[model samples]
Target: MRHRAGIVTDEMLTIPKWRFAVIGMLEALGVVTGMYSAAMLPGPAIPILNQTFLLWQLGFSALLLGRRYSWNKIAGCLFVAAGVVTAIASGSESGQMLSGVGLLWPIMMVVSSAFQAGATIIKESVFIDAVAHLKGKLLDIFVVNSFGSAFQAFFVLLFLPVLSNLKGIPFHELPSYIKSGAGCFFNVGASSGCDGSPLLPLLYIVNNIAFNISILNLVKISSAVVSSLAVVLSVPTTIYILSLPLPFLPEGVTLSSYFLFGSVILVLGLILYNVPQHNNIKHNSDSDFM
Candidate 1:
């Protein structure tokens, strides 16, 4: 069907191979390092570190794309950082406060996120200044995502031995681990057995897919920094959900005053990030082409 629609033609398949290769390699590294960092860090710390990527993205975008930011945008970025820091500082689990292992973990996550943001910005730049017949056609986010994901899977598989060893799994057990994972994925092995309701995994899978799609769409319509800001704005929503009496959560989960204040500040930051001046600038640029 894709072939009939010219979507899978030989012409479409032929692109500047080096561009795709570079993007794919960065994406692969990002995925591997992100997984490693997530394994090493605490859950709450992960979001805080992930949110820091907004700064990296903004800086790199300006440097690489010569993107200009309004003063409001800069203020918004600062507010986001302050809000995240406030929430983290006031939490009960904030004892480490970037000391010892805590410092290392967040740094690793930030590096990983920088790779991801770099890939995002490069892809967006390609779309903004496309060449030849590939101008609009190659800008498809789905195509970019499919290629990036394929490359990520290949790299992950290539590094399986290293990753397994890092996790303290024996080399000989790697095959069994792969087999068990495949079996569990297919729901045909002992590993498939779940202690809780089956609906949980299904819901998780659904949510994961939806979340990925939403993020990719955001990156397509806007810049990487905006996409990161959108994710940052969701921190409060995640906190609220965790505070609820969920089935898997322990009882007595509650939000602190600092967290609430930080959430409010984060929302304001989001609003500032989308100030009318930004839209006006974008509108004027589009009108130039028209």
Candidate 2:
């Protein structure tokens, strides 16, 4: 059926050579997100860190991208900030400040958001050039995501070995570098079910696919700042859901009805703002911002 539909098939299909540059770095991000979600994790701080990231993107867009700020954009940012504040205020697990390993979660979110913003800029700057020289979007996805996968894989590999070795190695038995490295690596690497589990690689692949695709389309349809805003709008939904108190709720986190409702309203507002309009600011600019 696939062949009849003009679809090609190959069991030995492989990602192109150039498609790996970004993967390793992104993998490291997944690792960080995982670590912060662990038991007794400081959950409120994640939203705060995300808020900081948006502010950074806004500043960079103003300085480097020369993004002309408008009243609507300003309002949008404010709304997002408000939402973050709300989430953070209500995201408390024990109604106390984030502490211990949980204290680092928000910081990780800042780093993650920074990398995401940078990825957006790089992807945009190179996308058109690649299209004119190489293949279009299809090849673009292949090359770009392959490189991303590779980058993420590199970090995963480097840390995975040491982490895997940590099983029998007593904490006092390890050197300072190994101990510190493991702590930091786990901060990002400790995802849903990581451990020495065989499914860790597969989980990372799934996470990358979900994250990268959401971001790739976002950049294609909007500016980095706008894409960052969209992320702000979208991510809370997923996180909130995962944090919910549904049947069989996980040990680490759970969401309330309030968060879920807030996410819905937030997404609706973003869609209204993002929908293509006749008077789009990008149209007024260099037409490239569109």
TM-score of candidate 1 relative to the true fold: 0.82
Best by lDDT: 1
Q: Name the Cα RMSD for model 2.
A: 7.9
On residues 155-244, what C-alpha lDDT tens digit does candidate 1 reach at each position? Answer: 767787887888999989988888876556556644525434446667888898788667876776776777777777777777778778
Q: In terms of TM-score, which candidate is strongest? A: 1
After superposition, candidate 1 runs with Cα above 4 Å error: 1-12, 88-90, 93-95, 98-103, 135-138, 183-193, 196-199, 250-252, 278-290
- Per-residue lDDT tens digits for candidate 2, residues 1-290, read 44344332231124333323553555475465545443334556555655666766666666655566665555666667666555545645534566555445456566676765555565554454444444443233444555566677777666654554644565455575565555444554434543434454556678978887767766655566666776777667666666656644545475666566556556555554444445657632323232
Q: Give the TM-score comparing model 2 with the true structure, all chains together.
A: 0.58
Relative to the true structure, how large is the alpha-carbon lDDT of every model? 0.71, 0.55
Model 2 error, position 46 (Å): 2.1
TM-score (all chains, Cα) for each model: 0.82, 0.58
Residue 96, model 1, lDDT: 63
